[model samples]
Target: MRYLEVTVPKGRRRAVLDVLDDEGIDYVVSDETSGRGFAAVVRFPLPTRAVEPVLDRLNRAGISDDTRVVVIDAETVISQEFDDLLDQHSHGGTKGSRTSRQVLRTKAEELTPAFPIYVTMLLISAVVATAGLLADSPAVVVGSMVIAPLIGPALAANVGIVTGDDGLTSTGFTYQATGLAIVVGASIGLAVLARLAGLEPAGVDIVVVAELQERVSPNVLSLAVALGAGVAGILSLTRGFSEAIVGVMIAAALIPPAAAVGITVAWGMYGAAIGAAVLVIVNVLSINFAALTTLWIAGYRPQGLFEVSPTRKPTYAYATIFGVALLVLAAPLVGVTLVEFQATQLKSAADEEVDAVLAEPEYNHLEVESTEVLLDDDYPLRSVDRVVVTVSSSDPGPMPALTDHLHEGITTHADGPVVVEVRFVVAEDREGDASEQIVHTSSGDRDS
Candidate 1:
């Protein structure tokens, strides 16, 4: 149950009271109170189900402007007469009541924070994400998600656009863009500092840590995750559910990828950085698009009829822009996916070929340890698979023959031209009284 205290102009009090009476709502009206400007106060108790309808009626009756309506939660209403009244209204279910537009507007306004808090949270989230990526810790990454403030402005952007509030739209966009910039820039600065301190992941190769790698190569699947998060986020907001879980979902699509971009940029891996940057862009657009669609379906619209027609053109334009961007982003993702698939196939074939070659009588003592198909940087566009085989052998005599046979087998089974390289480790058997022991030592790579 909700207790509403409404103050309206003195002349309109009777009309408002009549509407309340028609709705079967019990109320008490106090007229011309004190220093107020000819105002009357009408206090009423209403069932949750009737709140939206009552408010809508009052709004249409011109009681919304300047008139004050404050809703207070009724903990306990005890009276024999009121109990009967409540029982009569209880037949209509109150679950999932639609929130008033005024409430939603207030919510949007509250979420649009002052600049300092927004930038601070963005920087903190970015630093946390960077540290998580460096440590390859998912827990730390999720911690970052929990603190991320990006989802607010993202949803706000959708809300503003849908409501045709230019000020809200501009504020949302400005905050969102500024937050993203701070996150990326701060992450890059941290990465540079880490590198300068020799704290970066050891080696010149691109940081292939689990967190970084996962975000650096986003595909169609990533977009889907972002879109789903966006929908879930708006649903949570409108339903008055916990926003924390939904915030995590949005952060999952956003934070790590942005961190990846910064880390890659700091490391000077521009190609990988491009992929990470694309992932961030795709996720942001996908979230906004999904939220906009969800809000529209949820019956959210601009304030006035005049505003409705004007909103449509900009809505379509934004939707089209997002659609085209998604299509363009998919192109590189598709290429990356195809290349990865081909690499997997080539690796499998190479493994089988190496096993067969090592199974030969002359190379019987050799054991295949591992096989990997890596992209040859020299001919990346051509999709040349470099088959690297690591083998342990007791005899060195058959190594040459083994390499040739492995190369022949791999070249035949692989889809494209494959460059076969064999790495040999000599295993020496030592005779012992207690037990037989073997020692393996690397002899280095032998190209075939």
Candidate 2:
């Protein structure tokens, strides 16, 4: 519910009052004595969802650019008629619950902080994210996201573009670009410093770190995170949900990968850095694309553009640009997906071979433990580097022939050269038994 106050211009008071009366909205009219607009002031109460459409009607009824309209929250209304009006709009779905463009625009602007503060917050978050990635601490990484001021600029850009506020749109874009650049730059500086101070040892293999490894794999799944974040962020902004939680989600898609790019580059792993860089780029584009589409579908459009063509033209243009850019960036992600799929198939086949070999009578005492598939750190697409299988047995023997047999069986499923290694773990029972336990079987009987 909202309490609204609108100052009507001269000669437009009757149309305004008639529109209000037609909708059964209750309002109070007072004569304008300040002599600024030379008319009457109308105060009204409305359901939150009814504000936009009712305001549009008032506009068509001759509200001018100089007209003053103030919308504020209304806690309670005692009128049964107002309750019926609220019930009607409540059943209208998204359009009913959608925040007015006036309010939405204000929220976007408020979310965007001052320039200096924005940059400072961005740098701090980036440093924390970089440290968290290196330390492989998910909690710290999430903490970094909480303070990130990224959601504001990210959604504001789309909001401004959809509403045809050119200045706002431009400022939103500038803030986004500036914020990301600062994050990347700060991460690089910090990572390099960490390396120099021996916090990260020389010649370290950064990919071995679990958190950093995830950022280097830019697959189709990565796209979903970014798209979902963008949609949720905007929906939260317009639907009166907690934007702070959604803001963390937006940061999750961007901040970690952006930091990974710097970390990998600082470690001189240029190929791996490309993967992280592509992920960051793809996420940014996908988030923007999803945001623009979601806003349009929610029936938001340019306000106060004076002409319909001028309003719709820019909105369509911005959407098209974001959509096209996202598609272009998705190419590499698709490639990565295909590579990962093939690698998975190869690993599954290797597992089956190990199971079959262990089923043989001669190898009945050996129990399979784990199988690992390693891949190269390449951009867009990576290939299997090796497959290692670990088996456990208590028998005191070399088992070198098992390695040969396993390698021969696994390589048949590979399209190219893939190294296969086998490891044996000696087992012992709690009863101090180090000998193998074997079960002997006959045609119709089995014995242990």
The C-alpha RMSD of each candidate to the native structure, in angstroms, is 5.0, 6.0
Local accuracy of candidate 1 as per-residue lDDT tens digits, 257-279: 88888988998887778888888
Give residue 59's lDDT in candidate 1 (0 to 100). Answer: 67
For this target, which candidate reaches the highest TM-score against the unseen true structure?
2
Return the number of clashes found in candidate 1.
0
* Model 1: worst 10 consecutive residues (lDDT sum): 433-442
TM-score of each: 0.83, 0.90
Candidate 1: residue 396 Cα off by (Å): 2.9
- 278-302 in candidate 2: lDDT tens per residue? 8998888888889988998988875
Error of 1 at 138 (Å): 2.7
Residue 139 of model 2: what lDDT? Answer: 93
